[model samples]
Target: MRSVPRSAEFRNGGISFWFRELGCPERRAALLDTVDYDVCIVGGGYTGLWTAYYLQRADPGLRIALLESEFCGFGASGRNGGWLSAEFAGSRERYAQLHSKGAAIALQRALMNSVDEVIDTAGDEGIDADIVKGGMRLVATNPAQRSRLHAEVGYRQEWGFWPEDLHLLEHTDASRLHVDGTIAAAHSPHAARVQPAKLAVGLANVVEGLGVHLFEGSAVTEIRPGDGNARPAAVTEHGVVRADHVIRATEGYPVHPRGQGQEWQPARSSMIVTEPLTDDMWRHIGWEGREVLGDAAHAFVYAQRTADGRIAIGGSDAPFRTGPARDDNGATEPQTIAELWRGLARLFPIAAEVPIVHAWSGAVGVARDRCPSVDLDRDTGLGWAGGYAGSGVTAANLAGRTLRDLVLGHGTELTRLPWVGHQARAWRREPWRRIGPQLVNGLYRTADRRESRRVTRTSRFAGLAARMAGREPHEPGPGGNAPGSPDRPGAIGEASGAAGPE
Candidate 1:
């Protein structure tokens, strides 16, 4: 095991470092009585908040109420790795299977555009989340990783990504960033680094200012689809919120409702942030552009340079917690923290001595097919958008707009995207759910270790894991699992639970 700095503080399960820096916002009053509205959106994270923002903008007169179990952004929204990239959460080929390859390509392009949309919205709304459009860099530190990096570039090109969207970097260009042992790298301009909590809190205030009712500390026990005469409703402890349209926007943290329990499996990802670095340390690091960073490893690591000069890095070193249990408080294991620290040290030796100030973890929603979806039942007046793996930061925005279009009965370009109404199969029940992720994670970890030991090719363990997961080795999903499996690339986690109402 790698050595960890003993002086570092451990603040596990305290929400997250982002929330701590921003100071948790004062909670909005919980719902005290039943209410009626044109729309009731459960979960006040990015998806629900953005949905309310767009809906109110489209029609100011529409009554909208957003319910949250905790304060807005309390879940993955505030706990993510702060990457607003154009990466989608599902398989491109899988999305193409639902529509045409052209349609899937369009969806990818739309996500690329959504990265800008989020930046522009933050500016328009005066939400200063330290937004910086420095782009993203995926570095290859080993020969095996280099092979996968080039393969990913080719994969993107085959799927219609223009050169400007993503391209290879020369060794000199890759060295400019100064990540240790980087032999090759890929760059994409369609990404930004953000102070995630600031954006979530600011957006919450913006929607409330727009006359959207936001009720924090309001946990919805269940969501019921409307029948012939009844309207869709979000049943909460205080009261039932009935609306013409009810949207379930909970990602990862589902309040399970009936048969939908296994629809999304919540995966827990852990993170650690260092104390602000010194000026001398900064010079040695050479990440002046402050672009978000990732690696091509199967058990990948993701990182970002905070505006305050701290380095926040994360990975899926922790095993998935089985059953419906979740680490809602952002608790991280000591072993997980040590593993993440080693990753940081390996990438930037300068960070080895820097004391870690905080560590936390959060869950991300993953569909069995490893794709995200946005859908509404016009007949039932019910809708939902989640299963982002770990790419919810940008995908949530697109989902919000798509949900708005679906709610308003609009047939715009956003609605025609392949993920708009796509539905992935449910996760397997119980023992399988518990066994599958553990097995896959173990395989990927072994593959990474083998690659580190100078294996010049992608390990067979990774291929085997991909096949076990019912995917090909060339098909990358959300979080980094293997070549063809569905998993989050950077901000990934592991856990199991029933899909419940938002």
Candidate 2:
């Protein structure tokens, strides 16, 4: 039974619901026989499905198969906020270290391209995911964040690239746009929104069309790596999948560590959808922006309106325990979801009247450096992708192509991304990984405390002071997972405006 009310009237009159059609049907556990292929994907989410689609497209003759523990899109792919974005993990300095600039650019470009690829793929494959293209908005809550937003645009210009759909907003204009506490706003067309479940089903459909075998309900219990000429294989409840390469595509709740402790750490994220609002309510808010928006909150909160005219809000910075499981839908604890609900309601007054129609939680992998990993264990033929941290939608598609190119010995631009070389294996066991999140959250909380004393937070000194008070400043640390330190989250002013892609 649900701890909270599962069904209730939302702020607006229209009701809201979640996408229930997830996973691929062909991969169901009712397998009649075993099969072998050139590539065996151990997941059915975006990474696996996209990889299979691209791999088959590149070479129709290559034998590829995808195996999912549940159905396709059973994880984050189906339940996410439907954010189709190319936002970098954190910073460019991090990017430069991941791979060559060309590689990084190519990597993101491929993901950006997948936005269209996904839309077209959905239509062509007869999967209706309610894919919509409105653009994405990032709202700044303060001047400091406003400055950060400007710096980002400048940095992108220096990089000699900016998405055609980038825009910056001032406070006066931002305040009138609809939402409150908005000081600055940024816009970009490179991002998009989609119906989560349909995307997975559509992509899976496309892969199946290409003769790729898909197995659903085939939860992989173990993975056997390749040795010498032997290929890698995934052992599932239904049967065994053998292939030249085994790709682990589960993003949020990724599989157990393979070779290292930094392989993956599961972090729970929660979200709620409201009953569709009336047109008059929308007009009262005058939110014609029709874009996804995230604000500068101590705990990151992003909300977007769906194609069906309902609001989907998500919060990720809630305190959580690692490796904990929720409903199959992957929601966080009840209190956490309630807190996020309150946050959402605070941002939009109409949310009070709009009852929360549906709520769910899911998990994602956090690497040591807080980046995703695309590694191919040549010794075992067990290639995998994980640690997307928070932003994995667009990255997942590119990861799939990269994995395929690496497996096929094809040196394409897509494969040259820094993602392949950036591995965060064995992070949870790492001291920093284990203790870093807690300390960072605590520092953020402290900053929040200090900022609360004043009207606004200003200066790098303040951010520094917060960090200093929270953690002992040490030399730059390596990227990997370890337990995080317990500290309150100080408000690290956010960049309210969206800038050019990193």
TM-score winner:
1
Regions more than 4 Å wrong, model 2: 1-17, 20-27, 31-34, 98-106, 155-165, 170-177, 256-262, 324-329, 430-439, 442-453, 458-502
What digit string (tens of lDDT, one per residue) describes model 2 on residues 108-129? 5665686676667667778777
Candidate 2 has a TM-score of: 0.82
lDDT, candidates in the order shown: 0.79, 0.59
Candidate 1 scores a C-alpha RMSD against the true structure in Å of 3.4
Q: Backbone collision count in every prediction?
A: 19, 54
